[model samples]
Target: MTGAAAGTASRPLLGSAVAALALAALTALVASGSDLVSAFDARFRAGADRAFGASAGSWLGPDGPADAVGSALLGAGLLTALGVLLYRRRPGAALWVLVGLTVQFAAETALETLVGRPMPLPADGSAPDPGYSFPSGHAASATLILMVLLAVLRTGTRVWWSCLALGSALVAAVGVSRVLADAHHAADVAGGVLLGLVVGCAVAWRVGVRSPHLSGKETR
Candidate 1:
């Protein structure tokens, strides 16, 4: 590859690697019970509860409206993208999306187990969700799936920009919902977003290299 081509290819890989390193560092810090992280979590949780109150939990909790809407949106987006890729005869791109999601979920599960961080109590003093919560699965899934969709539709068009805005909004909403539901610490959501970035960038790199047509890049 020419220098420019190589650089273009390396950018996504480099981003993925950096995100991976940051995620690892955050996981280690959380696992070690860092006082700084703990303090920050406490303060953030307090502030969120004060600002949103217990009522927010009813609408943002795991079984709430936000969760339902986010799930529906993600599912529809992925299915639609898969259909389009298949129709375009870019089965490789579709396959990569499935593979990326599998990897993202597996990574989150492993990290959650490794960190063993418990959920915080809700503002209403309700029972916390039972599970290890270091990296929020909801946040990670939203980030990864929506980001992949964004990349697939990123053609520098008005539609692409609209999708970008919608995807960004959904991701933010999902992350905040998890925090408001007391299902994760603010740091947990951050770690999840970072984890998603790692997987999303890696998938994008693979798709771009392996299927330039899908990535809208000229094949060399």
Candidate 2:
């Protein structure tokens, strides 16, 4: 490969490695109950709870809007993107999307199980959310889905920027909602975003490198 090609190839691998390492470090910190992490989590959760309250309704809470974006919205977006790719005869890109999603899901699940961090208690004294909480699954899912859509539909500079802005807003909203609902720590959200980044970069690399036809370049 030429120097430019080599650099392009290494970029995704490097990004994934860095993100993975950061996630591992964060997981260790959470797993070990680091005092710093605990203090930050406590402070942030307290502030969020005060600002939004426990009864902030489903729209601003973790279970309704955020969950919808991560699950139903993501599902719809993924299916649509896959359809576009297949319609354009880019089966390789579609395959990479599936592969990347599978990897992201597995990684998120493994971290959640391995860390086994408990969810924050609701401000209203309700029972805490069930299951491990080292990483916010909603945050990860939203990030991955939005990123995949961005990669698949970036047909022009204007479209790419628009998609990026929208995707970022959605991801941030999901992460913040989790904190507001006391469903996860801020660290958990950060870890989930990093995990998504790791897998998303791999998918982008495969789609851009192996399936140049689907790179979505603008025609003159």
Candidate 3:
């Protein structure tokens, strides 16, 4: 490869490495309870506390209104449905989507275990969850799947930009829902975003590098 080609080829690897480092740093900050992180965590939790009490009368009715959107089952179901739908027409895309989701889930689980962060209780004094919480899994799930969809649906047109905007909105909604439900701290959601962005970018770069349709003639 020419020097320029070599540089282009290495870009994905560099991006993936940077993303992995960012996730590790976030995990360390959360685990060590560094003063700055701790202060931010406290303030973020306080904001959630205020929102929780204020939204009690809303349609979600205080017992986790956002449960349907952020639940693990729903996330899995959505991904599965997409995979099934795309399997026939785009087997590679379907397989890669599954691969991305698996990585996202496993990383979330491992980080939660390692960090051992606790979930905040619901405003109504519900029982504390037994599962570990650090990076919000719902946020991660929403982000990963949405990114996959965007890549698959991308057409190098104005419509592609629209999809990007829509995907971002959905991911943000998932994160906000988790906070309003008192299921995660703001830092936790932020970690999930970072984690998802890295994983999603890595997956997209890998796919782009491999597929002529994505990286060559169809390039945007």
Candidate 4:
């Protein structure tokens, strides 16, 4: 293999390694129960709770808006349909997106199981603190979905650019919403985004290197 080919081949492995390291660091940070992290999380929850007021906050609360968005993304079966379409049209690209999302899901589950970070409580004791809070699964899912969509639909048109911008904004909103709902700490969302991006880029790069025809690039 040429030097360029060798480098291209190695990118996925490198990206996966970096993603694993990020997960490990996040797990340790949550497990250690760092005083600084606790203080920051407390302050964030307090600020959000104060800003949104009780009623409005409850509507946009953890199990309300966040769960609704996540469910719509998964429960409504959009992702599955899209995956099927891509699988029929571009199997390489479909596999890349699937692999990336799978990696994110596995990493998030492991961290949630091992770290068991507790979420901050609301003032009125209304919001439920149900599961581990190390990495925001919603944020990770949103990020992965958006990135995969962008990769598969790379049309290079005005519409394509617009879609990319809108998708990125949507992903950011989901991540921020997790914090606003006090469902996760700022760091948890951040770590999830990092992991998603790493895995997404890794898979995309690998797919591009292996099969350019499937990368949504126009061939004339």
Highest TM-score, which number?
A: 1
Per-residue alpha-carbon lDDT of model 1 for 32-86, expressed as tens digits?
A: 9999898888777677667766545677565567556655655766776688677
Candidate 1 vs 2: which has more lDDT: 1
- Please give, for residues 1-220, the per-residue lDDT of candidate 4 as tens digits: 5676567556656765787687677667768987876787667656655765552455666556754664454433336536643654766666666677788889888878888777746444676587878788777766665555554443476655975787676666676667766677877887787777677667656654654434334522
> Which of the predicted structures, 2 or 4, would earn the higher lDDT when compared with the native?
2
Q: Where is model 2 more than 4 Å wrong at Cα?
A: 46-73, 76-80, 83-89, 149-156, 213-220
Off by over 4 Å in 1: 46-67, 83-89, 153-157, 211-220
Clashing pairs in 2: none
Candidate numbers sorted by TM-score from highest down: 1, 2, 3, 4
In the predicted model 1, the residue pairs found to clash are: none
lDDT of 2 by residue, 1-220 (tens): 5566557555766877888899889888899999989888877766765676544555545455644544555566567668867886778778877788788889888988888898876655668878888787777777766655555554466866887887787777777767765677889999889888788877776665553424334422
Error of 2 at 24 (Å): 1.4
Best-first order by lDDT: 1, 2, 3, 4
Clashes of each: 0, 0, 0, 0
The lDDT, on a scale of 0 to 1, for candidate 3 is 0.69
Model 3 root mean square deviation, Cα atoms:
3.8
TM-score of 2: 0.79
TM-score of each model, in listed order? 0.81, 0.79, 0.78, 0.71
RMSD for each of the candidates: 3.3, 3.4, 3.8, 4.2
